[model samples]
Target: MTERVVVDPITRIEGHLRIEAQMNGKQIDAAYSSGTMVRGIELIMQGRDPRDAWAYAQRICGVCTLVHGIASVRAVEDALDYEIPPNAQLIRNLMIAAQYVHDHVMHFYHLHALDWVDVVSALQADPKATAELAQSLSNWPKASAGYFADTQKRLKTFVEAGQLGIFAKAYWGHPAYKLPPEANLMAVSHYLEALEWQRDVVKLHAVFGGKNPHPMFLVGGTPNPIDLDSDSAVNASRLALVQTIIDKMRTFVDQVYVPDTLAVAGFYKDWFYRGEGLGNFLVFGDFPSAEAGTNLRDPGSWWIPPGAIVDRNLNEVQEVDMRADAEIQEFVAHSWYDYEDGNDKGLHPWKGETKFDYQGRGGPDTPYKQLNVDDGYSWLKSPRWKGKPMEVGPLARVLVLYAKGDEATRALVDDTLGKLGADKRALFSTLGRTAARTLETKLIADKMQSWMDSLMANIKAGNTRTFNETLWEPSSWPSEAKGVGFMEAPRGGLAHYIVIKDEKIDNYQAVVPSTWNAGPRDPQNQAGAYEAALADNHELHDPKQPVEILRTIHSFDPCIACAVHLTDEDGEEMLQVKVR
Candidate 1:
């Protein structure tokens, strides 16, 4: 076995992730991605009442708060063939669209932007030059020398105080950071603004779902019902508040987030050449039309069409069926679990198992060392679409839309490519992945106004319905019913599979976006997207600091749930990650 480079619990992301790579001198030969934690949310979901399953399943990840809850309820609704009303559908669409806007913007500025923008470098920038850079990009009101100078002063204080705060533990002053000092200063100022912007933007979720971060969800449709006069319900005041929040979200995304992304990508044009992994993409279409609910299985009814693109071919779009047993499968061969039949055999989510089978390796008390890369070293199962590793997330969704010849997606993709003076092939790299997320944010944020208007129109038309009472009771369900609820999450495709037996959840499994992008190798030795992207380029200029790895992995916006605190026999904090 050759010695490899390891980054245990890669920082500046949502969860704990360890990356080990076998290096061919300066470049990576083979790379490995480990979850470094176990998620038993699927196991905990068994035997619970199907109606209450969303509460437990949504707790899977605080970062992806409402996606799990929405998926969980959709699974049960699909099983009973419950059709929600038009008003309910519009409300749900608003929530989902708001999630895309809020999450994508936050990921760009707070989570992923630091990979390109150097805060330390911002201190050396001329505030006037930074103002010029900002004003040239957009007419955002915050573009002023005084604003940037104040931000630079804050950075200096952070450095002088010997505590970097949110800017700590990063690869500051690294050669990989190519953004000019003025650009860095401008980006840093927006970074601080985004932190406050997200706080105000997330209120849209609270208006309909009752609260943010795992908001209330009903199995049939939506929790908040439209009543123009009632304060307890989604009244006129709450509706106005939601509208204001959506406008704020769009303003930030249009003026600050999108401009900053294009600016950062300009300096890292080399990233547009590499970071292509597997080249197989998947997306379960989301934001379905209320009329499409008549047959919820049709992808044509969805705003974002569901399809698969293989080997970087854009002309041929392969149809994806979440209901087919042969379509979506998970392998535990390279994971910590064991399938009763065979480890290598692929099992659909309906029959997926959550058996913990860590055999005497990397235990809590075991002396820590290198991961067993040749064997199971991660808790995440390798999810495949029809026996192939598929990359899911922003990049996949954009390519699928562009291949389907969506006019809006094409205009954005073509415009971004033109601005960078590159071809369509540039969309397959790390910069492309990050840029796609920003474009998708614009597409969704802009469309949210239409949804809000439709909801108001429904109420004025005397159609103030939210939840469907037809299948609210478990007694209405069949003795045994299995269904899959899928959507294009902020990160990528997310789904929750549920098997109901006698009104109880017999089996439940949620294959999140992070699992599809961050899982380890399969039995056939096919690498997941993370491993494949790391080997695409020698982003590792120095062995000690691998900013390239963070840039690529963070582009996926990894949400491997949250991290578990590890400690010695004495109770004390072992690790602490500064969250912005």
Candidate 2:
């Protein structure tokens, strides 16, 4: 066996992930991805009330707070065949769109930018030149030389204090970094600006859902009661605040997020050739029309159409049927669980099981330095659509929308590709994944305005109803029912499958985006998206630094916490890193 390079607890993102690569000299020949923590959320929901499932499920991950909540409510609604009000549909669209814009910008600036922008390099940058560079990109008002100088001073203070703070533990001076000092400085400034910008944008969630980070959700519709005349409810003042936030979101996305992506991408154009994984994509589709009882399966009315694209063939998009047992199934062949049919067989979420069977190199008494990759390597089960692993998230959703011939999506994608002097094939690589996120942010942000306008117009026309009380009580549902609630979450296709028996959750399973992308090898010995992308033409410049590995993995914006977290037997703090 060849010596493998291991990157345990890959940092700078949500959740814990371990990557082990089998190296052939300087090139990566193979790789294994492992989700070290076990997720028993499905099992935890057993025997719980179906209506209260969203609250517990929303606790899945603090980073992806509202997605699970939304999915949970939709699952219950789907099971009962309950339809929400038109105003409620538009409100949900606006909230989901806000989440897209907010989450994408946060990921790009705070989580993923440090992979490309060297904070240490910014120290050597000329403030005047950085100002000029920033001005050339966008008409953002903070492009003055003095603004750049102030940012540099703050950075210098952090560096001189013998601590990089949030910039600590980064591979700053690595040879893989391609950005110039000036570009790095400009990016750093925007990074700080984004921190403040997000604080204001998240207020939109508070206005509607009552709070941010696991916003309140009702089964039939949104929690907020609509009453334009009532100040306590979603009144005129609250509606105006949402509009203001949407405008700010549009401005920041156009000026900071989109431009920064293009500028940084210009330096790493070579990335356009690597990190293409599986070549198959899946999106559940979200953002329904502002019509009462709008069908979610109809792609024509969806803002971001849902479908599965195989082998990067944009010409033919396969419709994704969430209820088909064979279409979307999870295999525990390489996961730390056992299925009743044995490890070789795949089980749909409606029939999913979470039986713990940890078979590592060592038992619970002792820890193994490396995982038993040949047996079960991860807690995340390999999810496949019709027996093929599919990449999800921004890349999948963007491609599906573009392939479906959405005029706005087509123009945005074509214009961006033309500016980069790249073709559609580039959309399959690491740079493509990153660029797709920015493009989706723009599309969602622009659509937010229309949603807001529609909402206000409805209010003026005396349609202020937000909730549908027809099936609000569990007594109105059938004794036994099963359904899947899915959406195009910021990370990718997020779905929650629920089986209700006697108004209680009989069984529950959540197939999140990260699981689709970062799962272990399946029963067929097929590598997941992360493993395949890492093995495809990835050369290690410095085995110790491993910035290249981080670049490709971080491009997916891996959120392992979506699946589980790490903790010791005694519940002591195992890993700790300070963040300002």
Compared with the true structure, all predictions reach lDDT values of 0.85, 0.88
Off by over 4 Å in 2: 292-294, 361-367, 562-580
Estimated TM-score for each candidate:
0.95, 0.96
Question: Model 2, residue 78: what's the lDDT?
Answer: 85
What is every candidate's alpha-carbon RMSD to the true fold?
Answer: 3.7, 3.4
Over the stretch 363-397, how does candidate 1's per-residue lDDT look in tens digits?
45434556667678787889999989989998999
TM-score, model 2 to reference: 0.96
TM-score of 1: 0.95
Predicted candidate 2 versus true structure: per-residue lDDT over 189-288, tens digit per residue: 9999999999999999999999998889988888988887887898888888998999999999999899999999999999999999689999889888
Worst 10 residues of 2 by lDDT: 571-580
Clashing residue pairs, backbone N/CA/C < 3 A, model 2: 393-492
Native-to-model Cα distance after best TM-score fit, residue 149 in candidate 2, in Å: 0.6
